[model samples]
Target: MTMPDINYDILRRVAETASAYRYKDIWITVGPEDGQLVIRVHDAKPTCEDCAIFPIAKVDYGSSPSVEVATIGSESNPVDLLNLEVPAGQMIPAGTYAADAVFWSQSAVEKFMIPYYASVYGDQADVVVQTLLTVLKPAAQDGSEPDPAFAIAHLPGSEYVTLANEGLPHLFLIRQSGRVEGAAKR
Candidate 1:
């Protein structure tokens, strides 16, 4: 299969936004929405009382990086970001964890997330990535899926991980580990 044509700059911008806001944990996801690649970032704090606590920014490809600059390109196919709420009490169906191992194994994880965090977080990116890997890798090996309550981290530091968007179809998750757990609009 042909690899998804990912615009890495867009991912980097979202990562920068999360870092700028100093979110302890963040959820990032990118996928086709209305025929264009839509990326969303959310504060992944388990107890976030309101979705407004998270600043949602969406930008088109090749646009300047600014939370205020929502529209980066011409009127056609402008990147539209939706205010996606993190999951609260929804039930994640059993076997949701089945495909994580295959998804995380691809170069996409590094090609997508690791470098973006490295660029945005600089020296601290290692710790962030390590913490993520340390937390999620064992589950991958054991074939145990992340429960709806399984958060990668919740402390006040740079910690984030890319997961399959639970809001979209399972096929999307099978292809890319990009969404924050339960952070997509269902």
Candidate 2:
């Protein structure tokens, strides 16, 4: 079994996009199980205590993280667990490949945490979005060479839009069905 080479920047960009909507934390997980590749995003919960309605009231508090995972495989070799196919012509080659997972929190306090005396608290969303966009553009440009046996579709029932482009080799946008199709060459 081998792991695929994952571009961390791309993963981080995806996480950042997901975090833009007030998610607590965003990170990526890449691993192998039963001769397959598994990718996951782990979203954390906010850390701040809920706003108090009554001055003397105590509110029960705890934080829990949410996780979303997607798996990919070859078009003809769909991953049974995820029902996704791999990109065309690319293979794992039976070796360990570099993988990266980044984690960051998006709590309101964490966003505005500054010295009590500091006069500046800027919105970090723009900065985060810019950085994420920069990282993602290159991957999108290089979409031509993605492994044929691997493809990713947004998790069902999630707000994420599926990614695909006409110029992307072995990848197709199923416009009518709104799904990404992979055509891997044997």
Candidate 3:
């Protein structure tokens, strides 16, 4: 069976939103086309010099840590930018966290979403996951699970959706099946 498509938008939001909530002066940019993630200080460069912006923790769902799937490296500090990119002459893995719970059960979307957002960026990060599940599950849609393929789309709906839709520009999911395919649009 095919795994669900990982939503770069959600991941980007998790990293950036959380950072913004914590560090309001940081700026983030996603460039999947260039296969890079650039982060820089907004209007605070040259002062802190060593100031660098990075995801405290990415929302990768895989059981293991990130492999060479991308050029997994830190952009040196004191530069105008921090770049996360797929390194040249390296092989990238196929597994990264998408909205696993969202893909599994559409009904659980809200339940999974609230806390996920909280953990990633919302002010409710301190809220217990168990409690969030309890409150959100009861109100979530039931029966049919939403398709994961569309998770990347900037769908129409609530304020949360609108916010989530605004994430790293041009980030994307890379599905895998044995060998690497040339970079193609999903």
In the order shown, the candidates' Cα RMSDs to the true structure are 17.3, 17.4, 16.9
The C-alpha TM-scores of every prediction are 0.28, 0.20, 0.22
| lDDT (10s digit) by residue, model 2, range 13-61 | 3433344333233434444444433333345322322211111111224
Find the 10 residues in a row with the least total lDDT in model 3. 152-161
- Model 1 spans with C-alpha error above 4 angstroms: 1-15, 18-85, 88-106, 134-186
Q: After superposition, how far is residue 134 of candidate 3 from its true place, in Å?
A: 20
Give the candidate number with the greatest lDDT: 1
Model 3 misplaced stretches (Cα beyond 4 Å): 1-50, 53-104, 123-165, 168-186
Candidate number with greatest TM-score: 1
Mind giving the per-residue lDDT tens digits that candidate 1 earns over 1-186? 222356555455455446434423455544445455444555553232211223444333454334433221236533212211223332122212212112233344455555744665565567645543433333454546543222221211112222333321211221122233432322
- Candidate 2: the clashing residue pairs are 73-85, 73-86, 74-86, 86-148, 86-149, 86-150, 87-148, 87-149, 87-150, 88-148
Q: With candidate 3 superimposed using the best TM-score fit, by how many Å does residue 36's alpha carbon deviate from the native?
A: 16
Q: What is the clash count for each candidate, in the order shown?
A: 0, 10, 3
Give candidate 3's whole-model lDDT.
0.29
> Which residue pairs in model 3 clash with each other?
61-97, 69-92, 69-93
- For candidate 3, give the lDDT of residue 98: 24
Candidate 2 runs further than 4 Å off? 1-25, 45-170, 175-180
